[model samples]
Target: MSTTDCIITSSVVPDELRLNVLPCYLGRHYLTGESMVYDWAARLCSSYEGGHWNFFTLSNGGFYMAPSNMDRVHVRWYMNGYSDMMGADAFGITVTLFALCHLAEHTLDDVIVTRYHQLREFAVHHAEAANILRAID
Candidate 1:
């Protein structure tokens, strides 16, 4: 695959996100950051029964974890009423973007705006960008 056809991954979730995203955003627990994302995703993703999942994050700050199966976890959810099969990677990133979008709509918090842009920039280049944008639209 070419450079434009790949997504960066981490063998495990980054520890830093426990403080920035997991606790307040994904869940209230610190240590269960990984599980929190998985559990929340369970609402839509059909399964995590696949092999070990890999984590994806941006250089600035964000977290998305997806199983190794090319099928990934099929997610059937969307904020805009558009729904279809989207990999867990794309689904997770899309939800995070939506959450950030809603939060930013209220006030112009620099931190929130920065994170929104960071993840948006990352998502636009991601291999699953099409799925993500489809869900968002």
Candidate 2:
């Protein structure tokens, strides 16, 4: 699929107010120590009915999503900064995924979750990252 299509499909959800939809860009910013990102995400979540959206902070960043089923998630990314000496830079992207199960489980709930669980059976697995991504995706 095209990149835009993939992103939209992953982030799209029913027009309900119970699901959590956190874009990847917001999540990354929150993880990278941007305080304003969290505030914006919180405000966006609060705008929904029934307090559907909620903000979550992971070790690496923050994300916004609905707390129940029937909610949608949207994310976008942008360039933040880069390193001149190391030729490195910081960038971001928004990501969305099915989150029906996360609302009730306090964990991931989708195809990604299954894949992560399988990956975890092996040694040297990033359980924490996997957990966060699983929910975000």
Candidate 3:
């Protein structure tokens, strides 16, 4: 990808929404002063199937799966199977977004309860981000 094929904005989400797609801002720092990406990863891991998400960090890139599927989980072509940084980050966001949308659908059907506030928050944020991205597109 060329340098120009990227987006460099003051906002991570489409607009300036802090709690947009992600549970928290990706660019912020936690109380430990570490990047919020770590916390985001943790939250994503905890988002579905009672925190059975398995996140593996390989030398190339990382991939995650819910319900601890060993045979079903493998690195993608982009993971080398892609980049150690970009690939992992991309897959992490994809997984989080997928979980959020999937749960949101079931929640709408009243199949899933909002017992976990994190899941509800993620669904709401992802919805808001999707609407903003759609408008931008």
Candidate 4:
């Protein structure tokens, strides 16, 4: 197995806000000797990228307009290494986006809502993958 560690990073409004969201799935797979992490990470990353773009478009720049407190909250939450940390981050982002859309007198159309659902699905998939990997370990 490879000795390289996995580095999962996330990008937000500002470059300085970038964070390592989680350990690399490759490293996790190597450590756990389980294939699920690789499979799930591929799936989750694809879904996450798509959802991110969809929400980004809907924000019309409002997403980045969040207050300093919100940004700080996100940065701190993302630093944790647990898998559920991703889920919380996902939920928090979704909620913040929806709230911002409403506060801006904008409606979250079906597309945006669908993207949130996609993110939720991806989170569940990741959770299942983690559970399976844990079981095998």
Ranking by lDDT: 1, 3, 4, 2
Judged by TM-score, which candidate is best?
1
lDDT of each: 0.58, 0.28, 0.30, 0.29
Cα error, residue 30 of model 4, in Å, equals 39
TM-score of each candidate structure, all chains considered together: 0.55, 0.18, 0.23, 0.23
Candidate 4's C-alpha runs over 4 A off are 1-108, 128-137
Question: After TM-score superposition, what is the CA distance of residue 91 in candidate 3 from its true location, in Å?
Answer: 1.3
The 10-residue segment of model 4 with minimum total lDDT is 53-62
Tens-digit lDDT string for candidate 2 (1-137) = 64223221113245653133333332322233233333333332333233333333222222323244323433221232211110000001111222222222433334334422322222112223333343233
RMSD of 2: 14.7
lDDT of 4 by residue, 33-69 (tens): 1222223333323333212211111222122111222
Q: Check candidate 1 and list the clashing pairs.
A: none
In the range 6-96, model 3's lDDT, one tens digit per residue, is: 3322212223442332223111221221222234344433322233233322211211222332222222223222212223323343444
For candidate 1, the lDDT comes to 0.58
Residue 91 of model 4, lDDT score: 35
